[model samples]
Target: MLRFFRVIAPAVLLAVTLAAVFWGLAIGGAADERTLLDPGDIVRYGLPLSRTLVNVSIAGLIGSVVMAVWALATDRDEYRIAMDLAAASAAVLTVASAATIIFTYIDVSNLAFSPDASFGAGLAQFVTEIELGQLWLWELLLGASVTVLAFAIRGRRSTLIVLIGALLTTLPLAQQGHAAGASGHSQAVNSLLVHLVGAAVWLGGLVTLVFLAKAVSRDRLALLVSRYSTLALLAFIGVAASGIVSAWLRIGSFEDLFGTGYGQLVVIKALALIVLGAFGAVQRQLLIPRIATGERGGWIFAWLVTAELAVMGIASGIAGALGRTATPVPQESAQDLVGSTPAEFLTGDPLPPELTFSSYFTEWKFDLAWGLVCFFGIAFYLAGVIRLARRGDRWHVGRTIAWLIGMLMLFYTSNGPFNAYEQYLFSVHMLGHMMYMMLIPLILVLGAPITLALRATAKRTDGSWGGREWIMWMVQTPWSKFITHPVIAAVIFVGGLWVFYFTPIFRWAMSEHLGHQWMIIHFLISGYLFSLTMIGIDPIPKRYPHPFRLVILFATMASHAFFGVTVMTGDALLLADWFGAMGRDWGADPLADQKTGGGITWGIGELPTLALALVVAVQWARSDTKEQKRKDRAADRSGEAELKAYNEMLAKQAERDAKVGPRR
Candidate 1:
């Protein structure tokens, strides 16, 4: 029966996605003349009045809710009962709205053909016309049911994630033609929905698969994992291919691909996916088998998965560009940058419109180079301290510092600087963002508490009382509170991305020697928040109970997904081209480019976030198991030692001052 599911599950999933894709294309390509309204009538008004939000209500809202509730029931295990309840509730709320939401879509889709009516009305009519009937209601039930069953065999989050992906197929029925991104409405709805689903399935499933595999046989785990991995790979390929093809249509030509700011950004995103795919291949071939071999292998596999998951975050940022507009060229725009001196570039004035960090350092501005060097030198200094702490009480501070210095120099001499340059110039910004937000933080968590610091500091009792008290207070008071609140960290994670991309200050971050510095900041801020959110090896701030944390995580993801969709749907330029005449020299339309960027951001961006959220929950739950074992061992040791010492002390007291030496 399990084998039957193993084979049938993926096949069924692929068929649904493929059928939905084709159905979308047929009507989308305009082969079917029975649209909500005639193009001829709409063209008279010169507007694509077809865009609507109802599609999302069907695919994301309805489908997601159903999947969530069903997952709750299936995931009702000893470890996650509360999680099951919350998810089931969410599913009830989201999926139960089907009757109402589906009616809204059908009403809009069947509206009469008329260009004279207001554009808003046309949009409404089109959305209402999409038939939301028994088929979808039943389909939603089946998808959620399958998801529940899948989670039963697998786990909770993994089951609903399967539905997340499966739910997206319903978009076509909402009158969103196959080439979804072509129409802004389709793009808006699917932008975050598709990727969110895929990421949840891939990243979350891998976490489950890898850990479960650890307790079982290599061949069994391998075969089971491989089945899922194949699904993930296919999903990734589907998203990438669909994205590229959609981009080609939206962008029009090669000129639009690189000749414009938005186009170049998309190209960079494509390249990043290629690189991630390359690394994924290496991980699959070299690492999974190694991990399946046993304990050490499992650790290595954990790292490999960490690295892969980390890259997905970076990929998400680049993909966010799909919702942005191409930089526009205005009348009377200057062709060249207005920089007169070195200081001009530093001030973000007279800089080229297309200026990037890597381009600035070469022939553009040599004066700022040394400043970047000094900055990295400082980061190395900090890293040295952390590395020293990594060894706990086992190593000397001086040796650790020296080791870090050597690593820093090696980092500079090898491929580090080049990669840093790329990051500053393009999607590298997002990559570094991931390192700060996810990878390095995870590394720090695994490094554990500063055992050496605690020990050495314990010997410093002769030092000033104020300093010691300060350190004590730092640990006992606000320090943990500042980082541990899940809401606080979630805000930072989502907000930092918003702030960097939405301001003129972002340009400053992109240029000058400060570009790398800003990247470092991004990495640190994100890393700090991410580590706090996940199961770090070190002590965390006040953690919510597992049930609460899982709920919050799910809500956090939903909010951000909606945020991306909002960006995709709106017709606005995020950054506003604060570069004066330089902004106008780039002929493309900023609003359209931003919409494309936002669409991609909304649709695909949540994938990594959702994946990370689920992984964190699973890892935290698993850690609870390990922690119980650790505590049991420590308690046993302490008990034995106390008994031995109590007997010895009793003998001494009996011979001397007696009175029951230390209470046993």
Candidate 2:
């Protein structure tokens, strides 16, 4: 039965994918007449086909590497098989991405192929000069890079890096999916990205498992299945949530779910998802447990997975078509608005109402990515805490509260009124920055999530890896040691202010969604590292002496103040093109707003700095007290033997002096 599944799964996947693509194209009007020049039949059909291959290959590449790192033991045959699968899939991804680049260029430019220098030059100009072409070119290069890395590197650490690279290869593709200069653009892009990654992991992991069904030893097979089951569950949730967001963005209304061709395709995909979810539930609840007990469920599991893969293929096909399908509501409605403001042109939203104290809490702009992150973060942290309590282990309630507060603050900074106005108001942006980099980290570092995770998660006695093992490995690695160093963390935290604001990075973050997300992640992580170095309860590679830590804190504060003062006193506006161009009817002048931001940098930023210093001072005093008590305990245990020995030595010395006194 397992052998039959191994043979049939690929065939079924190919057949269903092709059928779904054609069916969707027919319904979505892929062949509809248009005003623009058509690139011929090759591009009309070939582009979506190539895209389907790209999605499948990316899934295989990322999923195999993830499974290798998270499930299989490093020394086992299963690990090597997974790596080989990754390499092969990466190679396919490279080819598919290259094909996608060609198809996309042809589709966008309506260009004909020619075996001549003129054609080559045109292609080069398109890739180098055009935005759409450049995105695909970057994706292609990344795919090729992953292909080589996957083939050459098989060590655990290197595989992890390769997995990250594979994941990154999907970013450019994600950005290119929907028009960026539209309302809800950020949510659409974020949702699509998450959906792609989640689907890839779920689809690719299952495919790899089917391949490994015969290769893995019986004892390890159960463990690998169990591990993959957990990953699939998480992936399922990501896919479901992201799918809903994406569908909502495109479909606009529930009635359209049946009214429009795009919506109908979405309905089909959603149905496929439900089917996949049902299969996944059974595997997680029934098959996994049975397999773990040394039951022979491999054949049954393989067949079920094969069926799921076929369904996934249909969804992938529908997804490929959805990207090309025309929606009922035009994606560029914001751009189409009459007399749009610069803010509307750039950020896809109108200039927000003037900043007010109450507006910060009431005005809300949802950032789907961070919203999901905070939701899941708080949920998981609370679950861990609950698990510990249920096991009769005491966890500090304060830590849990701190974690929840931190997550809430993160959500607010990323999704609240501050986010709504940050693009238009420099001061608001600065407020969000300070909160992200300083206040939020300060609260979160006190939570000690890693410690909670270690205590709450069950230890895997089997050779297979799990979340705890992965987290432990990450913490103990040399890279973690280097990043956690006090000097390094301090530099990243303090130096980032000058580097980010003074360079094009500020403009990039303001203008591009991906760049903005990257800025948040970088600052948050840097802040967490710096906070950990100073007053973190979590274990780290090394701890700075209290006095040195104080000095570091003071130095960092000085640097931070200097940065703020520079911005405050600057004659010119930072990213004057962005903030100056907003053309707001309310708020302070651009320079004045910038100075307000600088004041925030200097004044508001100092609050966290002072709190950290106080915490460090208290810890230093407690350390001294603890040391004194340790000495007293030693004296009590030794009964003053050292003092008695010293007295005897003094007496011996006195006798020697008395004997020698006569000669003197």
Candidate 3:
């Protein structure tokens, strides 16, 4: 019965996916007279089919690799099976991505396929010169590369790297989906990326499990199922959240949920998700515990998993069609640009109201990615604290408060007026940078999250690496030690400011969303490392002496102040084209704003510097007190033997001097 179902699963996915594709094409008017008269049926039908193949193959590739790392001991037959699955899937992905490139070119360029020399040249030009072509080409190349790597690499660390590579391959596709000039463009892109990756992990992991069903030992099956179940839970949350965001962007209102073809497809997908979630809940809450206790639930678990996979196929099919379906609320509306200012055209939103003191607190521009990040960070940290408390472990309340405050500050800086105005005003950008690099990190370091994690997380008796193991491995690595060095961390923190603003990197970050995100990550990490070196209570490779740390701090402060002063006094504007050409209606003059930014660097930057110095000073005093108490304890333990020895030596010296004085 299990064998029959295994054979039937792939067939079901194929039949359902093809049926959904055709159904969606009909409903969404892909073959409408308008499109048929131009690109015709080949593009209308073939493009979405090829995209479906691309998505499924990519999922198989990523899911197999991730599962191999998270489970599948190296010596097990299932391990080899998982890697072979990854390799085979990568091969499929390579072919599908190549086909997707060709089909996408035909759809986008409205050019017929040809065999002439000019056709070859035009194809080359398309891949090299056009952004859409370049994206698919990159995906093809990444898929091909992973295909080779997956076959050759068998070590856990190497496989983990390949897993990351597979995830990165999805980014190009995500970036291409949203029009850059559309409102909520960043949010759409972010949500799509999360959606694609989450779906891949969830779908792909299930497929791999079914493939290895016979090879896995019955005893080990429960363990793999338990681990994969946790991953599925995370993936479920990610998919649900990102799906809602994507739907909101496309449908615009609840009324459109049933009113439009796109919305109807979204509703179908949502239903499939709800079904999958229920299956997942049953597996996690009921079957997994029974299986772990050596109960004969394997057959029931298998049937449930098979049903979940079938539902996932339906969702995947719907998603492929959704990619081609036209939405009633167009992402980029003509109405949006009817009376748009230059700022609106450039930023995809109208110029923000003029900067005011209260606006900093009141205004908001929520970033989906960072907002989720902050939310997760706070939730997880609090969970860790609660876990410790429930176990009768004492965790400092102060650390929890500091952690929450830091996350709140991070949320505000990334989503508040600072982010909204950063593009238009240089000074506001600096303010955001300062908070990201110095203030927030300093507070977070005080939270001692690492300490909490070590105490809170369970130790895995099994050889498989878990969160605790990975954290310890990372902290113990030579690279981590080098980065956490006081000198190295200080250099990165202080030097990044000059390197970023003075170079073309600043302009790149302002112009490109990915670069902007990288900039934030870099500053935040560097700041966290520097602060950790100075005042962190968590375990690290080494700690510097108080005097040397003070020296590093003072030197960093001086260099930071000098950079700010340079920015303030300089006549030339940094990123002259970006901030200068924003055409903002109300704000400080560009050059004056540049100076104000510089002043922020010099002036506002000092507050964090002073705070760090004060923290270091307090830590230094405490160290002295600790040493004095240690000596006092030693004296009490030894009965003041050292003092008694010194007094005896003084008496002998006096007696010898008295005898020598009579001879003199």
Write down the lDDT of every candidate, Cα atoms only: 0.44, 0.86, 0.85
lDDT of 2 by residue, 460-512 (tens): 76566677887888888898899888888999998888789878898889888
Better of 1 and 2 by TM-score: 2
Specify the poorest-scoring 10-residue window by lDDT in model 3. Answer: 28-37
- Go through the candidates in order and give the clash count of each: 49, 0, 0
lDDT (10s digit) by residue, model 1, range 258-372:
6766566566657757766776687668765765576566556555555554454344433322332332221111222443333232232232334345542442221112222
Candidate 2: list runs displaced more than 4 Å: 33-36, 292-296, 333-338, 458-464, 643-664
Candidate 3 vs. true structure, TM-score: 0.95
478-591 per-residue lDDT for model 3 (tens digits): 998999999999999999998998788988788677888899999899999999999998888888898899999999999999999999999998877678877876877899
Model 1: worst 10 consecutive residues (lDDT sum): 44-53
